[model samples]
Target: MMQVKSVTRIFGQKAALDDVSFAVEKPGFVGIIGRSGAGKSTFLRVMNRMTDATSGSLMFDDRDVLALEGGAKRAWQSQCAMIFQQFNLVPRLDVVSNVLHGTLNRRSTLASMFGFWPDDDVLKAFAILERLDIAEQAAKRAEALSGGQQQRVAIARALMQDPKVILADEPIASLDPMNAQVVMDSLRRIHDEDGRMVIANLHTLDTARRYCDRVIGMRDGRIVFDGTPDQLTTGVARDIYGADASFNEGATSTAIETLGTEGDDAYAQSMMA
Candidate 1:
């Protein structure tokens, strides 16, 4: 369980997050939706400890997440993986090597600098790539893969951390509709199969409703709505986005109507074999 209480982040004089408070008592897919500069990304950064909050406490179970520093902080980061909008792989490195970078914190800097990963780590990286259906691209350079495949490599890297929670900041904003579906499906599969909490900053209402178990709507650094997808009514969405009475939800929807028949079950079966 994670608890964020009275979390407020300041940027110079302005508050990027104002008294933000929420608790995740269980593992599930959560979507944070808001317009630009609405503090969605800032909130994720704070959770990941990439940015410090001016005042607040973040507690994960018995651990005091806010006070962790040095090795403790690094451990927290390894436990709570983050996936960015851009695939943050070393472009020149092979896909498997990029995935192995997830273990950098656990190894000495000198070893990582020399690219001397352990045999077990190498095998685990390959297994993760296979689970994500990208094992064939292991030897390919990270930059050689398409945008969607690059994102899958990013996901594989995150899984190498064996994280308890995955924080995704606008994960699908750059991809086409089919690619977006693939990325979202992979994230969902990770959450379901691994029982990890996946919190994503999503741009589209339809995507949130389709992929997220719960939706958190933010506006002007404050949460305006928090509930299940079904509870996110048109009126509530208008309030969250600060839209006029004429606001239409479909205008912001990028949801694909159908995905390929090779569904989650089939993928799980293949992994089992």
Candidate 2:
């Protein structure tokens, strides 16, 4: 379980996160929904310790996440992996090599810097790529794949950490509709299959409804609403986006359904094999 108590982050004179408090007691897909500068990214950064909270407590399971230091802090970071909007892959590196980078915290610094991964670590990378249905692209350059595939490769890298929580910061913000569906489907599969906590900063109401088990609505550095997808009604969306908001279907139902079918096909192939 992750417990955040009265967490506030201040930048210079402004408070980016204002006394935010929440708890995640179960493993599922969680969506943080808000407009630009609603503090969604800041909140995720604080959770992962990418940015320090000015004040408050962050407890993950038995450890005080906010109090961790030195090597312990580095280990904590590995346990709570982050996925970025940019995919963050080395464009020149092969996909498998990129995924192997996830094990850096556990490997020898000199060996990792030289790209000398052990056989077992290489196998683990292959397993993660297979799980993501991108194993065939293992030897390809990270930049050679499509946007959605690159995101999946990024996810594979995160999984190599064997993280307890995956914080995705606006993961599909730059993808096309079909690619967005594919990425969301991959995230859903990870949560459903691995039972890992997946918290994503989502940009659209439709995407949240389609992918997340819970939606957290934020406005101006404060949480405005927290509920299940069904509870996120049009009225509540207006409250989150504003009265003059025009919410469009970011990913059409047809696109998501098609992606679902593709996932089913992959599952069937795995079963057959």
Candidate 3:
């Protein structure tokens, strides 16, 4: 479980996260939705300690990640890998090499300091690529693959670390519709297949309704809403965004009236409404 206690972040005179608090049970899939500058990305970064809050505490599984020091912090970070909006891969490195990078933690003093390591995990890295369905590009440079494929590579790199929590900050924001589906499907499959905790930040309400088990809405650096997809409605969305939110599927908290193959038929009903 992860507990965020009255977390707040300030940027000079402006508040980025204003006393936000939430507790996420482990092994659950969650989606965070908010407009730009709503502190969505900042919240995710706080999980991995990529950014520090001006005050407040964050705890995971009975451990205070922020208090950890030296190798303890490094070990905790290795167990929680983050995937960003951009595919932050070594563009010139082969996909296999990038995945092997996840194993850097296992290296010893001379090996790490001198940039040397034990036997390469090329075979294991190859297996991760195969699981992500991007094995065919393992020998290829990271820059050569398509946008969706590169994102998958990034995911595989994270998996190679065998993380307990996966924090994705807008994993599909850079793709087209087709590519977005591919990436979302890949992420969804990761949770369903491995039962790993997936926390993704999304811009579209429809995507939240379609993929997440529960949606958390943030406004002005505070969480304004948190509930199952079926709990969403126009009124709820209006509070999250505004009156125009109803017309913009990207901003609404869509209520999943029926848990079907692809959730409720909001498309047909809302379009007619």
lDDT of each: 0.84, 0.83, 0.77
Pairs that collide, model 3: none
Q: What is the lDDT of residue 64 in candidate 2?
A: 80
lDDT of 3 by residue, 90-134 (tens): 899888888877877765656544545345466778888998888
Q: Sorted on lDDT, highest at the top, how do the candidates line up?
A: 1, 2, 3
Model 2, position 252, has a per-residue lDDT of 35
Alpha carbon lDDT at 253, candidate 2: 30
Highest-scoring model, TM-score: 1
Tens-place lDDT digits, model 2, residues 1-273: 888899887765556678888888888899988666567888888888888888999988878898888999999999999998899999999999999999999989899889999999999999999988899999999999999999999999999999999999989887999998988998899899889999998877788898999999876568899999999876777667554433355533323222211111123223433
Candidate 1: which stretches are off by over 4 Å? 246-273
Instruction: Order candidates by TM-score, high to low.
Output: 1, 2, 3
The numbered model that scores best in lDDT is 1
RMSD of 1: 9.5
Comparing candidate 1 with candidate 3, which one achieves the higher lDDT? 1
How does candidate 2 score on lDDT?
0.83
